[model samples]
Target chain A: MGEFHFYTKLDQTLLLGVKAGNAEELLAGIQIVPDSSIYHHTHRYLHQHHYLSPEPPNDFAYWTAHVLGDVVLGERLWSVDIVGFQSIAELRQTFVNILEGHLASTRRRIDCAGGQEFHFMASRTYVLPTPHVAHNLAEFAHILNKVSINSLYFHVFDAKLRLERGENDFSRWFRSLGKTELAEKSSRLDPYSHTLDGLRREIIAMVEKHGSD
Target chain B: MARIEDYASFVGQATIDELFLLARHLEGKSVQNVNSTAVGGGVAEILSRMIPLLKQLGVEARWDCIKGDEKFFATTKKFHNGLHGVAVDVGDDEYEHFLEVNRRNAGEMTFGDIVFVHDPQPVALIENRAEIGRRWLWRCHIDFSRPDPKIWKFLDQFVARYDAAVFSAPAFAQKLSVPQVLIAPSIDPLSDKNKELSEEAIASVFERFGIDRSRPIVTQISRFDYLKDPLGVIQAYKLAKQRLDMQLVLAGGGATDDPEGPAIMEQVKEQASKDADIFVLFLPPASDIEINALQRGSTVILQKSLKEGFGLTVAEALWKAKPTIAGAVGGIPLQIAHKYSGILTHSIEGTAQWIKQLISSPAYASKLGENGREHVRNNFLITRHIKDYLLLFISLFHEGDIVYL
Candidate 1:
């Protein structure tokens, strides 16, 4: 195997100028927004509150439930297994379906206040390389303990979900290194269920135990 | 005097190293920051601190301010008020003068790889963008929720000339040709206003201001401006005091660009009345340590602004683990999660109710304070701010829409 270089992501959020005061409007914006916007609405909280446990709800569910006061629709939106989708298109479709279904079934119309309107936003990301590189399994586990949560998030959540890499950057790199056990353990982990800090701790533990084996 | 590494103690050494790594990506590009003032205001204060740190991190950064006469400044102040949804009649000459001042400033200034212009004061500088091919970003630092259509329409034309427009809050943005990015403002945790104060310092500051520490203190620290609703803060305090015995402290100073500070202060003083419990302190710009002591000494802090960019005072109070009650307008919601971190209020009644509720429940207020501090540390620190700005600068160079990791 060769050296595995880690990269981190920094995001700049750009407003799309498209806003929604009600569920129908929100659905329309969701349909037309770019893939980055879809990704942003889903993973926004994951990045912002990376230290909190039992990962916070996505912007869509939180706004609808808390702001819009549509508890049932909020539950439906929240229940969408984000990690189950292979691409942003699929994840976006799931939201579109849920919102469309709710708007059709429920005759209740809810409009947030003037400032409470949900602003459609997208992120322009800059992927930069970090100083950490691992030539072997021992080096990789040691470096994992020191890398920033952003680097860990880049390798885990960003690589797995946004890039549609079939697997996270760590598992893919591990597969290349012929460490099938470490790769499988990492591949089995879900990135959104826990905080990024929690995710890093779990991965570090998996890597360390694999090294001992 | 504080180095980039001095922040390592607050946000760890790894976070400091990440800044160095990010700066490496901008090795070749020079960043030039232009605003209206070099001191006093938030933009100037932020740049004065950030430019030196950027240079220390190996990025060539410089700052300059536009030279404007009293007429120009007064007109810009009108523009400022107009942008905050205030009605002000702006004549054609005022418009022409705004452009003339921008033209003079733009002609005299040298461009960098990236020219970052802050607020509406220097927005028209983008008119010269075609002559000089470089990335230009217009960062609006006002409560742009509801601007006067006349002023906004006039400024929108010049603003569209920029590569991207950045606002402090999501609601502040409008539909425009350029991409409107959202970047919340931040406070330096190590700065005088936000730094830790000793018990003696807090006590002395309280004594010097004649505020009795024996009783609970309810305070609002902000520029005594109309938009800040200092008079409303006094009313809320008076209402809350009807039920609970507490001291009200309203402390703030004026910015170099703003001329209405003394007038607003007078209004606040008259509203506060002769009640010794109601203390109105007009502080100097260099009184950050005293401000920190005052914030630390307060039992509950209030930022009942009718309009705000980000309500940075909320962040400052929350950073000190002081339970806060602020208007839900603008960026206050970002800092407070409604009874979770701090309380968000809509009117004078709501603000007063929350003040009473927070003071009545010590355990709940303490919990809110803890959550508020954690929230500020995670999202609103200078490290996160520098990272965001670095990302924004780097994205200007990249051509395509950056969706995939």
Candidate 2:
């Protein structure tokens, strides 16, 4: 197998020039804001507040709950199982389904203040290759501990959640190296429950544990 | 002197290495930062620090100023206020003068591979973009949430011509055709204003400013501008002083011919009285070390702004691990996440209560300070800012890079 080349990412968020002051507009935006916009609203807080534990709420859920004053819908949207989605397209469709169901059952359109309106944004990320390459698990464990949180974020969260990769780069790479136990354990690790820093530590610990065994 | 490597200890060696790696793609590309002034205000202060650092990282970066007469500057100042949604009347001649100044500067100046224009003052330089044919980027440093319609309309034409626009916050993004990138301004942790100070340095400021070192101190360091609401801070201090025995020191820069500054100072004095505890010291604009000392020595820091842009003072205070209270406006909320990192207040009453509460609860205040420092350390430091900018410059070239949520 080729050496696992580490990569870090920096996102430059761009306004989509479309915003939603009301639930209808928000639903419409969700349906057609390109996959990147869908990916952005769901995952921005993860990168922004990477220190917060148990993960922070996504922008859509926050807006519905706080801005639109629909706490039930907010909770419902927040409780959406991100792990079940195969791709951002599926995730986007899931949001649409939830919003459509709410609008259908209640048939009430809620509008927020101008300042509180949801401005759909598309992130233009620069995924640059870093200097950390590991040909083996020991080298990978050593290099993974020191890579920036952005590198860890790209591998774990962005890979599985945004890129539609069924498993994270680490898990897939471990499996390619015939490390089945390591792959399963790494893939089983949930990213939403921990900050990127915390997630990095977790992955490091998992790799070291496997080595010791 | 301020090498990118200097940030290794503060932001880890990997973070600094990432900056070099990002800068590799832009091998021989040059970035020219053009603004109205060479010094003063946030744009200049940032460029003064950022230019050298960019060059040190092997990107050919230089800063240029658009020369303007008093009329031009005055018109631009009104445009600035208008961009912040302030009510300012500007005439046709004023707009024409602004264009003439920019046109002249464009003619005289040499354009780099990427011509970076900062704020509304030099945005009109894009008129010559077709002739010069360089990658043009407009960077808006102010909040555009409620910009005046006329001002926005006038500037929208020039803004639309840019290859891309950069804003300090997502709220600042408008419905422009250009791709708008959100890049927040940063504070240099190693700068005189934000660096670590000795115990004696903190003590010397209190002695020099006549602030009693025995009692706990409450501070709000900003200009005496009406938007900053210096009087509102004084009112909050009075409200909190009902029970707390703390000294309030309102320190900021002075030496401006603007009549409003002295008038506000007078109002702040009248509200606080000749009370020794209410020391309003107007230090020189370059007194970063003094400001750092004052922030470090304070018990609780308040930004208490009626309106603000980014509010780096709050970040400075937080970096010192001091519990802070700031108005939940502009980019302040991004710095203070409600009660977690620091307290965000809406009214003078709330500010007063937070002030009193934070002073009384030492353990809670300490935790908030630690959290606030961590927040700033993760997001607002200069190294991360430079890396973001480098990525931004690279993005201008490789517009095809995909997304990550």
Candidate 3:
């Protein structure tokens, strides 16, 4: 596993919002581009993914209100009626609209500082491959080679992505993704192993094999 | 031998004879109870009374406690809270340490024909059951209605290995393959805590504690644990005191295995110190008679637990013919019949309202207490507990057979 650092731009932004002690800035940063950072993407993904028969509201509102010290905004965000939204995308849009309205109306705002340094430091930490990058076996293999992996969280994301696309075995899909050696190695991978470095090494070896081929 | 016939007066001759008949079936079977503490908490208190009674009834029963360091206890305390549906910090290290302690205890601990492992503390002891060749029963004394899924899943692995699981209330039971038995924990009426004390003894207890008996007394007797919500009790008392003059007694002791007791007790003391009427008595471990006296002296007994295993204090107060106002959680409902025997409250506001009602209407309070005592006598006494265990032990051996009493 890599050091406890923020690997995504969204994490850096959220950390800034957390440090700024501003809920408006945090919500602004979180909903910036919808899919900008893993944090933003994951929330959007989870929201969209479970949209029809979605689970209860995630901790976005709680983090916004409690951790970021914006009770008014948090309560407003939490009070958003998600009953009629048919998809996670629709829910995310509604949530963003509510958050934006709150942000515009609220007079309180914290001046966010030290973004560059925070970004530089966070770049060194491990972050899971984005859901988009992990959409397929080939893209997943490619992303795994470039970034540090958080194995447990990544596995869940990968499993869900695979289940959505009708793929189960990484090796079998790697064969279809045209990385046969990687697929062979993927079949032998211990899914239960929590070590990121071991998984990183396995991915690197498979990538090396693909490069040689 | 503390003969079954000795309990004739409290439980009646027929009940004793029925228990004796059940005990005869398991006359020579070895029954051992393994818990986390030997004193302090209800599990230890129950085992201390229960083991001897089991022995007297001719079931070769013994009690054993698991050995653990401060760290292990801290983890187990978190586990206890987690099992009660409280959000607790039970990380990987805490989990490993808990299992390591259990594994160590599992190696050294001996068993009986039927090993009764009480609560989550010593639950993993069933790992050694296969080798030891003993029928293990996991006796869960806490509410497991909505346990932290991670902790519950971890404990469930060990629980599934048991021959059967015992819960204090039907609501506390989870769906498991093993036969689940609802065995409500009981208070020994003959014990110092539940036994009738003379007016002088009761008055002396009030005098020692500097409690003013002139005003109505509201007492909550429980261990100094967050789950007991001692702070909430003080808040309820303050609310009630706004309308009526009452002296609140928060009397309890610490459990050896619960490391959080001292910290929680300090918080209780601070909250209680705001009002001079609220007396915080950190009673010593063996101060059962004092506890009994405090209950006897009280106008209304409060057990405002945020979460409860069984809240034996409710039964203890009810047995003494005192109207109890307790939280509507866990096994408290089984003891209290809501206005019929005792009142069950959901919040501090509700508790305060009931406290005021009970204190104002002395006639109604006395009636409730009378009903409560009968309710306890019919159900919550230790004689019924012993009979349940004997029946449970017999059921373990005779698996499919319907053992009629």
Global CA lDDT of candidate 1, please? 0.85
Local accuracy of candidate 2 as per-residue lDDT tens digits, B1-405: 688788887888888888888778788888989998887788888899898988888999999898889998899889887887778899999888889988988889989999889989999988977678988888888888788999899999999998888887666778778888877888999899998889998998888878887888999998887878888888898899999999998888762544587888778878667666798887876798999999999999999887677888888999999999998667786787666689887789989999999999999999889878878887899987897788778777764647321
Q: Can you give the lDDT of residue B148 in candidate 2? A: 90
Candidate 1 residue pairs in backbone clash: none
Candidate 1 interface RMSD after superposing interface residues: 2.6
Among the candidates, what TM-score does chain A have in each?
0.96, 0.95, 0.33
Model 3: per-residue Cα lDDT at residue B208: 93
Positional deviation of residue A7's Cα in model 1 after best superposition, in angstroms: 1.3
User: What digit string (tens of lDDT, one per residue) describes model 1 on residues B1-405?
Assistant: 879999887777878887888788788899998999987777888888888888998988898889998878888989998988778999999899999999999899899899999999888988977888899999998888888999999999989888888888888879799878888888899888898888998999999888999999999888878878888888898888899999999888763344676787777778767787888888987898989999999999999987677888899999999999998778888888776678888789889999999999999899889878878887788877887788778777676655322
TM-score for every candidate vs. truth? 0.91, 0.92, 0.59
True contacts kept of each: 0.65, 0.49, 0.00
- Kindly list the per-residue Cα lDDT of model 3 for residues A1-213, writing each as its tens digit: 111111221111111112123545445455443332323333332321121122223345544543344667667766654323324455556666776787678776744221101110011111222233454545555555544232322343333232232222344456665766666665555432323345555655665567546
Highest DockQ model number: 1
| Native contact fraction (fnat) of model 3 | 0.00
Q: Give the Cα lDDT of each candidate.
A: 0.85, 0.84, 0.66
RMSD of each: 3.0, 2.8, 22.4
Q: What digit string (tens of lDDT, one per residue) describes model 3 on residues B68-151?
A: 999999888788778766788778988898889989988887677888889898998887666788888888887776789888
Give the worst 10-residue stretch by lDDT in candidate 3 chain B.
B396-405
